[model samples]
Target: MENTGSFYNRLTLQALAIVEGESDLIANLSNISALLNMELENINWVGFYLLKNDELVLGPFQGKPACVRIPVGKGVCGTAVKDNRVMRIDDVHAFPGHIACDAVSQSEIVIPLNIGEKCIGVLDIDSPDLSRFDQNDEQGLVSFVTELQKVL
Candidate 1:
């Protein structure tokens, strides 16, 4: 198994290449979601939630269908956006106001996407294993999003 450092390095390089010469938001998000879904192990869901009309609307994802909209300050995704910070929930059931988009999702990590100071959307990843995400994962995904933001 690849370590987090290497995994993320590879992910970043690939993501950069994927977005090269592609300026379309939806197309880039679709590819990013697909890349994360394909590269990450043990993840049940991978997607993007775009900020629209003061709420998060599902953008592109790979997995089962997910919630269509989430209000700011509600659920993990909303909370991440509301606080403009990254949220790594080890156990979704224990998270207050947790939205159960996937019944089997036990852990989740939400990375708020920002262009300069403006919050545009978020990158959400879900896993079936409890405590699936760690500090390393958080940092790694944050780096991934940082690179992703340049093309958005």
Candidate 2:
């Protein structure tokens, strides 16, 4: 099995190449979905939540059923958008006011997808294992989101 840091680095490089090649949002999202689902181990959910109105509307994803609309200040995705910070929770159950979209998800990492100074959406990843996401994961995901902004 690959270490989490190496996994993240590979994902970042893959995303960079894909995003540079595809300029369309839908194509970018589709490739991202496939890459995240296939490349990242231990991930139960890997998707994008676009900010629609006052909530997060589901965009492209590769996983089980996810929450349709997450308020701006609600769950991990919401908090990340509301706070404009990357939210990386080691244990979802231990997180204050965590929304259980997937009971099997023990850990989560949310990266705000930004356009200029404004956030457009969030890249959300969840794992069935506790403490699945680490610092390298956050850094890699943040870089992925930044590349996504330019393409989308």
Candidate 3:
């Protein structure tokens, strides 16, 4: 198996290749979600929640059906968008105000998608294993998001 850094580096490169010259938002997000689902291991859910009218509306996803709408500052996805930062929860059950979209989702990481000073959405990944993500994952995913921002 490849190391985490190498895995993410390849993942980010693939993402860039997929989105290159693709100006359609939905198309880019859809392809990205599929890429993450195919590449990431042990993750039950991987998708995007786009901010709309101060709320998060479910976008393209690669998992079972999820919550359609979430208010800002409410759940992991919401808090990330509200604070304009990444939210990585080792255990979803312990998180106050966590909206359980999937009971099997034990750990989650939410990365807010920002365009300059405004947050447009979030990239949310949920894992069934506890503490499935670490600092390395965070750094890599942040880099992935940074590359994604350039095209968005």
Candidate 4:
């Protein structure tokens, strides 16, 4: 297996390549979600939720359908946006105000997508296995989001 750092390095490069010339936001986010679905193992859902009108609206995703809207500061995704930080829950069930879009999702990670000081959206990933994400995954995804911010 590839080391986490190397794996994310490649993933970030691939993401950059994929969105290189694409100027459309939805198209880029859709493709990114697809790319994550194909590369990340043990993940059941990968997607983005864009901030709109003080709430998060589902942007693009891979997996079963998810909640369409989340109020800022409400659920995991919302809290990430409200706090402007990444939320990595090893066990979603224990997380207060965790909105269960999928009951099968045992673990989750939400990375707030920011441009300067304003948060635009979030990259949300879900897994069925407990403790599916660790510090490495968090750092890697944070790096991924950092690069993604440049393109968007």
lDDT of each: 0.94, 0.86, 0.96, 0.95
What does candidate 1's lDDT look like per residue over 59-119, in tens digits?
9999999999999999999999999999999999999999999999999999999998899
Write candidate 2's Cα lDDT for 109-129 as tens digits: 999988888888898999999
**TM-score between candidate 1 and the true structure:** 0.97
**Model 2 superposed RMSD (Cα):** 1.8
Please report the TM-score between candidate 4 and the true structure: 0.98
- After superposition, which runs of candidate 1 have C-alpha atoms over 4 Å from their true positions? none
lDDT, candidate 4, at 12 = 95
Number of clashes recorded per candidate: 0, 0, 0, 0
Tens digit of lDDT per residue, candidate 3, span 24-125?
999999999999999999999999999999899999999999999999999999999989999999999999999999999999999999888789999999
Model 4, 95-126: lDDT tens digits are 99889999999999999998888899999999
Higher-TM-score candidate of 2 and 4: 4
lDDT of prediction 4: 0.95
For model 1, state the Cα shift of residue 107 in Å. 0.4
- Would you give me the overall lDDT of model 3? 0.96
What are the TM-scores, per candidate, against the unseen true structure? Answer: 0.97, 0.90, 0.98, 0.98
What TM-score, to 2 decimals, does candidate 2 have?
0.90
